[model samples]
Target: MGEEVHGPLAQTPTPSAGMQKIVTKHSFFCLKGKWKRGRHVVVVRIRSDRMCPQKFVFTVGVVAFTIAITLGGQVLADRFELANGETIEGTLLNPNERPRRVWLVRSSDGTSLQFDADAVTHVTRETPVQKEFHKIVSEYPDTIEGQWKLAEWCQEKKLEKERHDILEHMLELDPDHVEARRLLGYSRIDGKWHKREQLMAERGYSRYRGTWKTAQEIELSDRAEQTEVAQKNWIVRLKKLRMLVDKPQSSDSAAKEIREISDRHAVGALMLGISKEPAFRVRSWYLESLSRIATQEAFSAIVQIAIDHPDPETRLSATERLIVLGPHQAASYAVASLASEDSARINRAAEVLGRLGVSSAVDSLVNVLITVHTAVVSDGNSEGSTNATFTPSGGGLSMGGGAKRIKVESKNEAVLAALVKLTSVNFEWNPTAWRSWMATRQSPADCDFRRD
Candidate 1:
């Protein structure tokens, strides 16, 4: 009769007039009827003339006590299904709050009946509608029409997988089922099936078809996606990457193709080719592709190209592309390259920063000179004689296909050239001069303020 709505819970709507009438009638007759019915009520009709008065009184008291206990547990209404498949709807009376081995149900006809819970197969709490659905589905579990009904119910309930499963079973039973395909979208035609959009597109149907395509169309769309997924296999992409490495033209064409690929597998294939291709030109091509890819991984592969590859032209090409990719945005990579002991990678990084006009390289260039000066520099070294100890910290400089331990500076070259190009100032052979110039320079670090 009374209900309270909590904040989290929705307000329970009041029952309709028709529902209230039915419930009010059902609750009263279904509970109080047993007392009015002389048949199943007290069972005290057998008047014993032979029995003692005290004994009769005790027997009547016991009967009343039993009835009181049964009535105490009754609810407004419930329905019980017996083992024999017979159902009884009435006010419920169970000794325990939950249904168990024994139940006392009082019917609307004023008859009370005790039922064994074991004999009752079901005790519905929410509604009998759930039981009805279960009974129908259990009775015809594998039937096409039965499953169709279930599928419809599932769809209405927004039970996606359950609805799809039911539809699949229906298709198994009848493969040519157009309704199933229509709901799912996509249908087979002459063996080679067409997509929903293609099918709907290739033929003009009534405006009655409306904007919503059938399930058959959706299935065709799914099929196309699956085909695309298949085409994106890593092995297939790897082969394509390999073929495209030299195709149309080198660097430019390969770079264009690599830029276009969005698939993860294709990216992996391109990276793999960059690192593993045995031929210099092939690896070079892959290197160009990675640069255009313009990802962290692509940047790393390009750095590796500069590190491990001996080809100057390829390294220059990769470095040129790298500078155009925002030198400041790629500052960390340049720093990492400079930190390396590889001569080729160092030179490439210097070149890249210089091309980008990154004046900040001056300090780095000065630091490199100061660090290696003791090891690589010689006294009065105008004659170009030099000696550098090959240590783990400072790798032997590469020259003429050999790891050269030393090279004399004629005023300054290579790395210094890059520093001078960037800062527009040359310290020549004086690392201290470069440092002093850097500290005193009034212009911004990127400014080309040198009086070259």
Candidate 2:
């Protein structure tokens, strides 16, 4: 599973004619009922049926051993930190063969060691590539154009997160950037809002889907399981929600009733209820109803929900609804969330901004990139300073990743991608490069955020 990838068939050489026949037979009939292309196999011959079974097990064992030799190696290169202030870097193996209380992690150069929760500080896999990227960004934090080129390259290659971070950096360098703002979904037509379909018709160009939820997704599989309101009167539902927000004992019932309501005046009623709803739960439900209604007025009501709601979840729901309605203007809702302090909310905001690629988020994102990390070393220490220049080994602009995570590393990674996406620049991971870039923009582009 380490960097040294070994193909399954790497060890097994092309079988001889006699062996090939048995292998072909084993592949087609013994293993799978039908022959599959590119499947590998090995075969052995036996003189008698009694000897054949014993030899068969022996042959399988031999094949397994061969594979082990091909894939496994004693070259341990993983790094481990100990509680005793000792650091070791070597190949670490976890043989999950037998149940043993004391697990062993041997070093590459014939050094034996064991892990204990209290004794080990940390363990990490060797990622030369990541280290290299870190180095490059650290070196040219001021080379705004170079980072921008890398960001654009990442964008072209569909490296969404990486591209995003590069753009964010570019924005940090040049906030009023037309291309970055446009790419980031900060579209404005004569100071009016525009969405995905407003500028681009190609669904392929869109990062995410318009329909966050399909028809099947909205429908309740078992409506019978819904909480019984125990009240059939529509007016009573309205009265319950017109109460305190934190004290929402009756709002749940009110929401359930409002959700099921389907009449010509339902939208009007919901909108009115949203405006008057004192309970946050009921207000959240009103927004839900508006979303379900899916009308022009519904969008307006959702926006109102975003503006008026105190609950973060309610505002987030409003944001998602607005984005689904018009992603071109998703940045409209996203910028507000980016300004929030909650980590979960900030992460969601970052995602929304990532898709928008709007340059409007540059300042906020730069603030995040510079501020949000836990410094490995504190200030006032010369050794802790990050001002030293660096150069990537075997210099070549390259960045890519598969699925994303949301840990501290992943959060910073997301921010980096966002900076790239917003500014169409690859600061790689240099806040200083971004700051330098930002300081140079005098006559800014017309990409500053404004709402209708």
Candidate 3:
């Protein structure tokens, strides 16, 4: 078919030995050849059969051509070894000299640099993409549209730096090129295009990590990070201090240091020691230190200790400390604990709330005044039928049956006491009268003295 006519229509300088040429009408052309630096050059030209080539111009269609030079032995980036044990990586410009007395490189900043042969120990010039990039740019057009075409080709090859350079070059040709400006991170704001940094500056934003953030946000984040670092440092210090505090010889000094602690960040580390210390005297010291600090975190840890501590005296001590901080705070926390399924916790929380004397917890205390719990009770009964037998020779046997049991209800006394103490009225165990009194106080704006 048309495959015969797809061969090279014409080529200049006739491809020398070791050169390969392939052409396909409306398809693509692949040409391979070796350069002087032992690098193989591959030029992929996408062509449209309808376009006619004028002179030696290689631009063919919308998707014109691409050049990809590959290393001969799998080498990638350029490496230059200096005599002083330093290495330099860049695009080497003159790699095909006969004597190679001089080496030249185009630096990342687009500056031309030269090096004498004696100063360099060795050179590994591989960077095939950079080589092809320079070659294509040398022959490519200088116009914005022309450079944009090269930019598209670089994007296809994933040559980011080269694509960025071509985009910058497009900006130089025409500053208002919309696509180029957009690709280069420029936005049209208020009729003028501003770069990303400039736009961020105008909006009072700073780059944090990779995202834009306000100054206040950055400050808060910095403060939180510093607090975390301080907390970790306190953790390590407290471990050593805890060991010292256990020893009689250094206990006084360690206790003094912990007592003098003013940093709120140490609250978390102090809570760790307080929760794990078995000695009541040492735990008291930890609690005293937390109370001295009095941060929200410290208060919360104290609240948790008041509810979950195994020692009743210690729990009462924590509850007293919370009361010292503020009665309302302790009352709020204790009221929440009233909902616990454990009867003991309900009593303890009621005790805490009653000691705080906050009327706000009256409703909660009334609710848990008599919590009913389910229990499986067993009866002293036999599994099946009871039997009795009397044998000869004075041998006798008899069986006794057991009784069956059922579930029972219980009451919490502490909750009732808390409600009576809070309201100054003894509803005793009657929750309905307590709730009715509470409702009357809110609606009628007067106390209800009637009791059931």
Candidate 2: what lDDT? 0.48
RMSD of each: 24.1, 33.5, 16.3
Residue by residue across 1-452, what tens digits does model 2's lDDT show? 11222333223443332232122211100111111112233223222225443221112111211111111223234545555544433345664525434334543333233444455466666465433332243233344576566666556656565466666556667776677767777677787545555455433332224543333443532232232232234345555544432366755664566665554235656766666656666666767667777766666666655544556666667767776776545566666655554444555566556655566677777766633422122234343333211121212222223212221222456667777776677777677888787767542532632222
> For model 1, how does the per-residue alpha-carbon lDDT over 227-268 read when each residue is reduced to its tens digit?
557546755656665666656666466555555565433456
Q: Is candidate 1 or candidate 3 better by lDDT?
A: 3
TM-score computed on alpha carbons, candidate 1:
0.37
Candidate 3, residues 1-452, lDDT tens digits: the string is 11222322343233232333333332111112111111122232223223443212121111222222221212124656666554544457787887878776553433334567776687766556765664465445667677778889889978886687778767777899999999999999888988998879889998999989999999999999999999999999988988898799999999888777878888888888777878888778778888988878888888888888888888888888988898787777788888786778888888887777777777777777776654332343545543322111222222223433233344788888777776778878787988887877773322322243
TM-score of 3: 0.57
Worst 10 residues of 2 by lDDT: 26-35
What is the TM-score of each predicted model, taking all chains together?
Answer: 0.37, 0.25, 0.57
Give the worst 10-residue stretch by lDDT in candidate 1: 20-29
Count of backbone collisions in candidate 1: 11
Against the true structure, candidate 2 reaches a TM-score of 0.25
